[model samples]
Each structure stands twice: as structure tokens, then as C-alpha cells.
Target: MQRALLIAAVCVAAVALWLWGFGGAEHVTVWAAEGQRAAQNAMARGLRSLRAGDPGALTALLGLCFAYGVSHAAGPGHGKILIGGYGLAARVPLTRLCTLAVASSLAQAASAVALVYTGVLLLNWSRSYMQSLADSLMAPLSYGAIGLIGVWLVLRGLRKLAARNGDDGHGHDHNCNHAHGPTAQQAGAVRSLRDAFVLVGAVALRPCTGALFLLIITWRMGLAWQGIAGAVAMGLGTASVTLVVAAASVTLREGTLARIAAGPATTRALGLVEALAGATIAALALQLLLRAL
Candidate 1:
């Protein structure tokens, strides 16, 4: 059915996002040594300018947005994921899911920024040891986190379809929101400033390449504080697109997407999409693991 076909398309998009966003050495023009030096120099430059005040933060924010947008648009792997997620968006209430996307994106971008800032203190504290520690840990950890995300998406999709056996033909019409603890109503929807801040805090945990790359560059530059700017910038950049999409999803009409977004029949049909994404992630993860080994 047409719905089933859409699943395949969605799966391809997911795999593509990874490739586009953070996939491969081929896209990198800087040789390892050159990159290392550039990073070191940039960090040095960044530190001297810290006294320049908010400019560094402003520039960092712009740089992050530019970097993330470019990566999202041009990175084949990441592009695929965006497309695939969009496809899924067609099936679900975009507003709800967009919140999740924003939450995740912000988390990823913020984490990257935080790590970059930490690079300075880390370097100052132990130099060679810290560098060694980071080198040994960062790549594997990033790859593992990304791979886990892919797995989570596949599983979530499957679960949506599994809940009911009624719908078939590829997509189901279901609204799926899985959360731990209590329901929203029980938690109270009151608008408290502390609650808002807590929500914002929770939103900044997703892993992001922009933050990661910025950190790497800063660490190499030896001006670790620059990384914090980069992180904030990255978060803003991701939010630019994500927040717009979320708002649009909220305002948009809830159409047939809700119908085909679920059920056992749709689950079986959507399997190929899941498989493709899984295979791509697994392959990439294996390659990284092997290289590490």
C-alpha cells in the first residue's frame, strides 16, 4: 500500500541523516595534523578575545547555527534522518513530536558546548593525560550514543504499530507518547517560572556533532573556553529550525497522517524502513568499533 511505501522512504531518510550530519571522513578536508593545529590556534585566538565580552558568545551562536544548519542540509546521513523523521511526522501529530525533537536537539547541542568549555580546564589540569583520555573516549561515546538513538527510533516506531492489530497497509493512525512516571495532567500544567527553567534544563541533553566538533577544535587550539560559546551557538542553531517546525506542527491541520501512523499491519510494512536504518547504524558503529579496536 502507499502507506507501506512511505515507511521505506522514511527509513531511508533516517539513514541519510546520520551520513549527512556526522557520517564519514571523506567530507573532512583537513588532514589530522592540520586540523589539530587549526584547533589549537583557534582556541588560542578564542581565549585572547574572551575579554571582548559577549561578542565571542554571539559569534559562537552564529557559528553553531551555521554549522548545524549546513550539516543538517548537506550531510547525507543526517539529511536522511530528517527526511525520515519528517515522513513519520506526516503520520503523527507534529506538534507533540516536534517538542521531542526540540528537546533532543537542544540537549545534543548544549552537551557539545559544555564539553568544549570543559576542554580548557581538562587541558590545564592534566594536558597529555586529559588529551589521551578524551581521544580514547569521545569518538566511541559519540558513536555509541548516536547508534543508540537510531535503535530507539526503530523501537519506538515498532511499538506504535504493535499496540493495535487493526490498521495495516503500511501506516497507522495512532498518537504515541511514552513517558516515565506520571501523566501530564497529574503533574499539573501550571506555568511556574521554576518549572520552565527545569524544562529548559531537561531540554539540553541530546548529543550533537556541532558541539563535539567545536570541542575537538577548541581542545586542539588550547583555548577551551571557546567551546562553551560554540555549544550555546549550536543549541541556538538547531533550535532555529526545530522550533519553527514544532510551532508549525502545532498550528497545522491533523490529517490522514494520524490514521496510518500505527497498528500490526503497518508495523510489518514499516519493517524495511527500520531495517535500513538499523543496518546503516550498525555498519557505521561496527566500522568505528573496528577502527578503535
Candidate 2:
């Protein structure tokens, strides 16, 4: 039954990949772009209604903000890349990964709020200046941080491979009983928490442009609370999409692991998969960083 389940999961994953590879991605991109344009227009209309003191205008505006976020997240973005890559490379629990995805989205929204408020109220910076800072400075910083994460993953994989090799060279029997020391376990836990922080921080360093625009406009219109609420709504909407990605990545990874024979071979395969995913992430992040610069 377990084998059957694994096979089913693998088959489903394969079909999804096939569809995504054969123009589905492009179609999704076009649809997302259209959704974004429509949402933006609706938001503008909603804002005008709010200015006119129309009933339910605030609700409409918040709904539009959420829709805008979903549409924006559906497009190609580095956040997805980072989340998906980390999910594929790490042996984390699905719930934990999904939680991280949501946290990162919320953190991103918070970053946007912090930046806009700090710039407008404290620094007395213009919208153009804030936008330029995000684009020119924050973007490259985020990409560079993501690149470092990829490198860390690669190193982790290498260490696993080296440990496996060492075991083999020492003629260690797989069936031999051994236990990890408390120090080692504690270190592993600490590393896991650190990795989670880094992943969220890297994504949060560059706030969503749409959120920034909304915050600034709302602030100017004296709807500061509304803007902050809408930004949180948008974050939840974005989390909806990232959660799906997290699920898919976990399912695919688990399915692959289930198919592999347990033992040294499985360990080796996992290491290789992690290393390859990390390498791809690093290469893409490097390219993006260069483009941002």
C-alpha cells in the first residue's frame, strides 16, 4: 500500500511537471499578469470610492489588495525560487515548510510597512526614493543572501557525502548500533532554526513593490490603518500560493525518497539531490543578482 501510494504521488508529480513544461507555465504567467492589471484597476476604483466616502469602500479596497497579492505572487519571483529550492533540498517537515512559507510572506509584508513608514515619517523620503532603494539596493542584497543560502545547502550536502565516505572507509557496518551525541543533536536543531531565519530574512529583505505602492498611497490619503490591514490581507493571499508550492515540493521529495532503496544508496541519492538543487538555486540567484546590480 505504501509503495502504491508513492507511485501515485510520483505519477501525479510527473503529470504536473509535464503540464508546467508544455506551455502551462506561460499560460499561467499571462493569466497572472491579466489578473494583476485587473486587480490594480479595481483597487484604483476602490480608492476613489473611499475618497468619496462610499459605504463598504474600505472592505472593497482590502479585498482588492488581497486579490492583487494573489495575482502578483502567481508571477515568476525570487521568493518562490527560494522557498521551492529550500523545500527540495532540505529534509524538513511539510508543516514546518508551509509555516516557513507563510512566515516569509508575512515578514515581507511587514518589511514593506516598516520601510514605507520609516521613510515617510522619519527619513522624509519620497516615494521615488524609496522605490529606487528597494529596487537598486534591497533587491541585490536579497539575491545575494539567497545565493549564500544555496551555498550553505551545497556545503551541507557535501558534508553528508563526506560522512558517508568516511563510514565506508572505516568499514563501518550499516547494521551497527550507533547514536548521535546530545551535542550533535543540539547543534543540528540550532542549525535548523538558523536556516529558517536566513531563508525568511533573505526573502523579506526585498519588499513587494505592490505593497509598497499601496502603503504609500494610503498613507498620503490618510488611511494608514486601512493600508496596514490591506497589506496583511495581501500577505495571507500570497501565503496561499506559497503554501501550495511548499506542499508540492514536499510531496515530490518524499515520493522520490520512498522510491529509493533505504541505506547508503538512499543517503547518497539525497545528498546528490540536495547538491543539485542548491547548485541550480545558486546559479539562478547569481544571475538575478547580476541583473539587479
Model 2 regions lying over 4 Å from their true place: 1-23, 172-176, 179-191
Could you say which candidate leads in TM-score? 2
Give the per-residue lDDT digits (tens) of candidate 2, residues 114-179. 999999999999999999999999999999999988998898777777777666676556466673
Using all chains and alpha carbons, the TM-scores for the candidates as numbered come to 0.46, 0.90
Task: Score residue 287 of candidate 1 by CA lDDT.
Answer: 58
lDDT of 1 by residue, 1-293 (tens): 55554554455446436635675334532343354344445534554465356465546444534455434423222322332333332233444445555655565566555554565555453344434544466545544544554565466445544532333332634354543222223222343444234333433332454456556655665645555556656555555555554433322212222234443333444443444444555455555545644
Top-scoring candidate (lDDT): 2
Task: Give RMSD to native, each candidate.
Answer: 9.6, 3.0
How high is the CA lDDT of each candidate model? Answer: 0.45, 0.83
- In TM-score terms, candidate 2 sits at 0.90
